[model samples]
Target: MKTFKSASAFKPQRQTVVTIGTFDGVHLGHRKIINRLNQVAKTKDLDSVLLTFFPHPRMVLQQNQDLKLINTIDERIRFLSDTGLNYLVIEPFTIEFSRLKAEDYIKQYLVDQLNVAVVIVGYDHRFGRNRTANIEDLKAFAKTYHFEVEEISKQDIDDVAVSSTKIRKAITEGQIDLANTYLSKPFVLTGKVVKGRQLGKSLGYPTANLYIEENYKIIPKEGVYVVCAEIDSKPYFGMMNIGHNPTIAKDNRKSVETYFFDFEGNLYGKTLEIQLLKRIRDERKFDSLVALKAAMQKDKAFSINYIKTLQ
Candidate 1:
């Protein structure tokens, strides 16, 4: 999919169907919205464009914003790129840009700049200065732009609404089963495998260390997890620890170290993707290296058993 950093940079395609949002997680709810966009674009022969945001509007609009994104920019890009979108436009949210009125946004950005033929919006999606443009208001403005607005179905799972906020809350609360359903896949964390202190190697359980680039990406609480790590496009079962290595080291920095079962290679500088299956145990410091190694052995055993159950 083609990417544009801003609408100004996006040259107007002949036919375009645009859906606007931050698309933080691109979760099930977001997928439902995007599905309508794809259908609209396909039926009308319009190019599908995803107009998303960076730093989310809330971060700039609200005071003391505590933004915990479900998907980082990289993750969002990778997710949307696979949906057969023609373009994904990422607009940087700023104070000046936030003040644009609803009519002005539609007139200038969508109609004039993007040359949007049809716009598919979610049921609750609001835009423009102070988020004053509701679906009703947008419909009226759509006539002026000579474009159609579609309100996609609001998705629900088990009678509960599916949303990025709800999914994030579920993950935070260790309700990953529910989060997985909303995500439509296992929660993934992908990064480059970097070198660690060789602490795990010394314990006779060498691990591949991964560096997380986006701080906003949600990580499960500190614990041992049954993980599936992919390296060189090959999947391997692994036991992963997401926490500060307080067992044999003095440091308290959060780290993600995974020991691939019966796998060995030079992983340094290699990119890896990991899917967290389940949490086995919470993180805790051990009194001695011997104690830590024993606990890790137990963790590995639990991970294997867990994988067995999965199979």
Candidate 2:
């Protein structure tokens, strides 16, 4: 698949069946649109493309910066690439770019640049200047431009619409299971393993510390989790604790410490992708090191037992 950072760079000669959205998590609802595009492209023998924005339109348009996101940029790109689309256009969302009128944008970017033959839109998606574009507006633009417009509805679970914001809320409130249900996968964190205090090593449960990325992808509030740790390209059973280390004298830095079960290797500077499986226990400040070690041991046992049930 080809990638273009802006509409001007798009040079596809073949007719394109396109879908536009942030597609942040590419959750179930997004997949419905993708399926629609796939069907349209296959029937029409046109190239299917996805257009999305960086810095999230909200981040560029709002005063308050939202920190938490379900997926990083790389994760989103990788998944979209794997979806068999012909192109993934990632354009920057700047003030000037955001100010384009609906017709101007549809003409300049979609028809003139992308050469779109068909546009697949989500049922409730809004675009264009002042967010005024609706499904009817899109259809009118398609009719005027001699292109096809397909509007796909949101896929719901238990009668509630699945959305990125709702998923974020679930993760924030520690409703990980609900978030996972919406995401169709576990809400995960990816980071680099860094050198740490070696406190877990002292307790015979060595842990790899994580250096978080700047995106501030949401971390579950201080707790132990039955997590799947991916390191050196293999997923392993493990447990992770995220919080200020309350066992020792308190400090200001919050940390993520994960211990790989029945595995030994050099983790320093390696990347770890942890799939948070289930919350085992809330973080607590133990009175002594022995108490902390005992609690960790129990957590490990609980995680192993839980994972075995899944297997």
Candidate 3:
């Protein structure tokens, strides 16, 4: 798929069938919409385009700094690309952009910029200043612009809403398996491996500490989880702990650390995308370093057994 960083950068070569949304997770429900978009594009012999916004609307409009998202902007782009879309446009959301009247937005973005032949949106979708317009308004605009407007049914929209809510709840509660089931893929954490205190090394399990730069990225609940990652084009299974190292440090800062089984290499400064497979247990403060080490050993044994089952 070809990606344009902004709507202005996308000079469409042909009339396009478009769908617009944040498409946060690009989970099953989002995929359903994407599938329909692709089908309609194929049937009409038009280019498939997905127009999404970055810095989410709520984040910009309400200054919602605390709103966590399922996927970082980069991750969302990657996921959208896998859906067989012909074009992907990431529009930067700003107050100025939000102020465009409904008709102006449709004319500039959908008609002039994208040359849209059809627009696929949810039944409850709204646009214009203060989001005053709805699906009916879009159909009215389509008549003026000489294009088609398709509204996804209320049932589909509800399923998408429920899936999004449940997925977020599952991740926040450490229900990785359930979240994965809903997402149709493992929950992923992408970050750079940073230097840590080397406490895990002392315990015979040196770990690569992860540092995610996107503070808005949602983190799974505090626990040790079975995870897998591809390093240097090779797959490796591991266990990850997401919690404060209470036994070693009193600072109480949460950390994401992973120890890859049967793997040896320098990972500092390397970016890794770890996929959480299952939650093993909650994180806890042990009485002593000896107790922590013993607990880690058992965790390793259980992880290896779990990995074997997968094999």
Candidate 4:
């Protein structure tokens, strides 16, 4: 897939069939729309172009510093790369760009810049300053731009919207399976291993302290999760904890720690990308270290059995 940082930089040699959205998570709903876009482009003998924005519009419009996303920009690119798209335009969305008049947006960006032969959009997609233009307006503008406009199925449009909300809700509620069902893939979290108190080691389950740098990347609710990661190019099954070590210390800060079953290594400073498969239980305090260790052993046994079933 070809990637362009800005619309100005995207110079398509062939006429384009285009669609635009943030396309967060690249979940099942998004895949359907992308499949339609690719199909239209293939039948019409044009290149498929996905014009997605960075710094998602909501983060800009609402000034929502606390808003989180299911996928980071890099993760989005990685997801879209597998969809057989021809062009991926990463438009830099800013306040000034948002202020562009509806007509100018179509003329300058879609029509003149992209040489778009067709535009595939959602039934309720809105654009222009303060989202003044709707799907109808896009169809109306198509006549002047000499391009065809296709609306994604109403069911698909609703599914796309709902899936995003549902996935986030599921993750926040520690419903990994539900979220994965909608996403069509396991929920993933990536981080670097850092030094920790080594409390798990004392319990015979050495844990790697994960430090996630992306503040906007959504972290699932505090719980123990059945997960897998690649270490030394080999898949490793593990149980992860995302919470404060209440049994170890009353004032312990929250941590993402994973104990890989049957694995022994020094993972300090190594990056790990963990794919969460299921939530085992919520994090809680135990009466003593002995009690906590016993509970952890049970969790490990359950996680190991679950991993075996997948194999």
lDDT of 2 by residue, 220-298 (tens): 7678888886566777989888888877734657899998897888888877678888888888999888889889879
TM-score of each: 0.89, 0.91, 0.98, 0.96
lDDT of each: 0.81, 0.81, 0.93, 0.91
Q: How far out, in Å, is residue 274 in model 1?
A: 1.8
For candidate 3, write residues 201-309 as lDDT tens digits: 9889999999999989999999899999999999999999999988897587889999999899999999999999989999989999989998888888999999899
> Model 1: how far is 93 from its true place, Å?
1.8
lDDT by residue for model 4 (1-311), tens? 98999999998898999999989889999999999999999999999999999888888888787888999888788889999999999989999999999999999999888999999998888999889999999989999779999988788888999999999999999999999999999989888999988878878889999998888899999999999999999999999999998888547688999999878879998988899998999999999888898898899899989988999
The deviation in Å at residue 11 for candidate 2 is 2.4
How much RMSD separates candidate 2 from the native structure? 2.4
Task: Give the TM-score comparing model 3 with the true structure, all chains together.
Answer: 0.98
**Best model per lDDT:** 3
- Clashes per prediction? 0, 0, 0, 0
The TM-score, computed over Cα atoms with residue i paired to residue i, of candidate 1 is 0.89
Cα-lDDT of candidate 1: 0.81
**Candidate 3 regions off by >4 Å?**
none
Candidate 4 deviant stretches above 4 angstroms: none
